[model samples]
Target chain A: MIFDTQRAIAWINRIAELVRADVERLTTLDTAIGDGDHGANLDRGMTAAVDALAEKEPETPGKVLITAGRGLVSKTGGASGPLYGSGFRAAGKAMRDEGDVVALSDALEAMLRAIEELGGAHHEDKTMVDAFAPAVAAFQQAAGATADMHTAAVAAAEAAEAGLAATVPLQARKGRASYLGPRSVGHEDPGAASTVLIFRALADVTAE
Target chain B: MSSSANGGPTPPSVGIVLISHSAALARAAAEMAAALAGPEVTIRPAGGTDDGSMGTSIDLIGTAVREADSGGGVLVLMDMGSSVLTAKTLLEDLDDDDAPAVRLADAPFLEGAVAAAVLASTGADLQTVAESAEQAWSMRKL
Candidate 1:
């Protein structure tokens, strides 16, 4: 349950793989309400992040994610680059500060804070916060109960999935989808879906 | 890049960066701003993602903000959506000690860029330029 440099690297690699596999679906979802480049953009960013991680070989778990975040910021071609990149960077910094299950919750909290602060997201905005906020809350509850990292991560991942599903019935209030107004309802939000992928990646790595 | 620091002709007192989702749109806006404001003003057109897509790239905007900063400051005007979000991130990351101060103008992109550029070319300070740019919010198309 301890996040090491290896585990952090594994998490990122897993995310990249998942994004590549889900690109078509992500793109389709985005095309419904967004600019239609979410999947390809994230795929390209995550691929470059993996390459950057390999080249950097950061010494600590925190540095690994931080370096990957910097790669995301530099390489990604959309808002998610900076939004998710900044979130990861903040989470990595929190991880560096604390190394226990509590740190995992704190890191997720930091990621949520970064995303909300940067994106100005409120709950039910049908943005990444939809998934990220619930994920953090679930992880925090587990971590507060002194649950193991795997358990907390699993809870977080499941919450993220539920949040993603919840987005389907909501109208977009921010980002490109907001322009669609009421038409944005009934479609899964691309950002929230990607956020689910992030939590799933974390849970998978932690479980392993 | 302080115009007053030297005995030479004054440079623009402030710099401007125009951020848009379209590269051509940013370039054209900057071009028109320059045509009206003259060449002395530091204006950078940071448009499109790094991969030549219709989105904002934080890296591109960061570069433009840094490159455009004279000793005065940089005023950033962005189009909607990612451009605004991305610029706000860079704004948060910026430190006044390390770089010039930055102001994000919430105004119409083209109008704000032109207005800010014109004011900057006149040796106005950062606050004045930002205000000029934001004034475009009330600009009437009719």
Candidate 2:
């Protein structure tokens, strides 16, 4: 089954709920390495995104994502705002109106590249790219192997989790956390943690 | 361009936008920059989220950019962190045909805004205003 507009809307709504539940956790992680606003920023952004989707009821999965992205940029109020917002818009524009498994794979990569372009974060920089890049790679590999949306989503989520875990041992090379140098090594990057949540939300929605 | 009946070749003033993470800070800086410059020049403060919290808002920045441009290009000066990213995102969205082209000035926020404002008040072009703002970094106090 294709991941249609409803599925995409469900994914964002799920992300909003997940972010709301994990706000304190995200905030704690950010506080350890960055400005301590990750949780609140994402929560507010995702919540607004969900509202936007409901109001606009975009005709296609891509339009839904673009609308959600606009909401995030307008309300997230942090670095993640533009980073994640731009990623979603790029992904949406790449997908256009299509929502096939192949489109999903391409959209994931597009989102990853957009984030990299916006934040200048690369793999192993202990930012969201750590989680996002691996997730896209995993999804692409899985989709190329099976062309199954659920399988690809699961693989992406697990890869994102592993990437998030790896960030705990890394010295941040970018973002506000980089200001801390080696002192940032012990904490998991908040951006990576949020990326994990994002993939997990996708996997959960795909499973449904 | 038609010259004013009385004034001689009066060029349109370049617009200035100040972006910061803090709402109060950006407004205060705008106030200072405007004071240094004349009141006729438009200097806008695009700061904080819509709900009055810390962090830059893309919507706010977009609106400020649109409002700042007075047929003369707008010069944007941003504080550190996401303010730069937010402004950059908006700038990327601007097309070549967009009216009153916008340029981001990579200079100190307060000092750059002050310098840019002063120069803009002189009816300088966008490039010159941007250069003046960027050059403000060299004005280090010994």
Candidate 3:
């Protein structure tokens, strides 16, 4: 599937809707190991991003993602704002017109790089990187094998879900959850859960 | 006071940006720090989300860093988590030359802010302000 500007905007809008619907669930997950504000903060940012995209009417897929990212950076409070904002912005920069599976995979890789560089979190850190890194790898693998955006996105989302689940039983080594030490075990990382939601949104939009 | 190029008293040589999740907490800390640092130091509070809810704002911190800096460098003191991440992201976005030297101090928020402010007010440089804030970590409470 060719991911165009319209598709990017649709994906963002869908993400906003999904995040709003799952705010309580996400916040509950965060309350177990984080500051319990991830859902509300991300919801607020996504809402603003949708509004910004509607107002800006960006002409290109890259512009759409960049605008949405800017909105998130300005509207969302906390570390998630900058981390997610930079990720989206980096992906946008790497994306191309009528982007194919390779392009999509490259974009996800760029997003993961930006997040990793900014957060300094690695795999098994029980942070968003846990999900994001694996999702990027899954996208690359699926794209290399099938050269299909839908297949790549679905694979990425599935990998992200597994990564998110894996966060449980691992002690957090970054962010507020790290302060809890062993107490953080058994609680899924809020950032990782949110990363899963983002990949799921990507998969859903591409499947449509 | 040292003379500026314009022949007026030189502004303080360093500034402070206090970042926190709670707007009230940041503001109160800035106020307390100001009491010790006097009126000359530039100490800006960038706290809470844009809508005044709990959480740190990157836009707010970016603006605070720009405003607090008066050619002198800015030292950022963060509470935890997102605050530090947000500040680091903001720094990365800025151009190296266009942006003033900004340092993130690893210290307790309240103590660091107060200590940094006092140092800045004395016309200390950016490194000195940041080092003073870090020195707060060694302060023993007993």
The per-candidate count of clashes, in order, stands at 0, 0, 0
- lDDT per residue (tens digit) for residues A1-208 in model 2: 6889999999999889989999999999999989999999999999889999887699999998899988898899999988999999998898846688999888889999999998887779899999999999999999999998989999999999999999999999987889999999988889888999899998899885
lDDT of 3 by residue, B48-67 (tens): 98778888888788889999
Give lDDT tens digits, candidate 2, residues B1-142. 5354696866777999899999999999999999989886899998898878889988888888889877888999999989988988887778768656889999999999999999998888999999999999999889
Candidate 3 docking classification = medium
User: Better model by DockQ, 1 or 3?
Assistant: 3
Question: Which should have the higher DockQ, number 1 or number 2?
Answer: 2
Pairs that clash in candidate 2: none
Candidate lDDT scores, in order, read 0.87, 0.90, 0.88
Q: What is the TM-score of chain A alone in each candidate?
A: 0.97, 0.98, 0.97
Model 2: residues with Cα > 4 Å off, grouped in runs = B1-6, B96-99
RMSD of 2: 1.9
Best of the two (2, 3) by lDDT: 2
| Angstrom error at residue B138, model 3 | 2.6
Worst 10 residues of 2 chain B by lDDT: B1-10
RMSD of each: 2.2, 1.9, 2.3
List the candidates' TM-scores in order.
0.94, 0.95, 0.93
Q: Estimate the TM-score for candidate 3.
A: 0.93
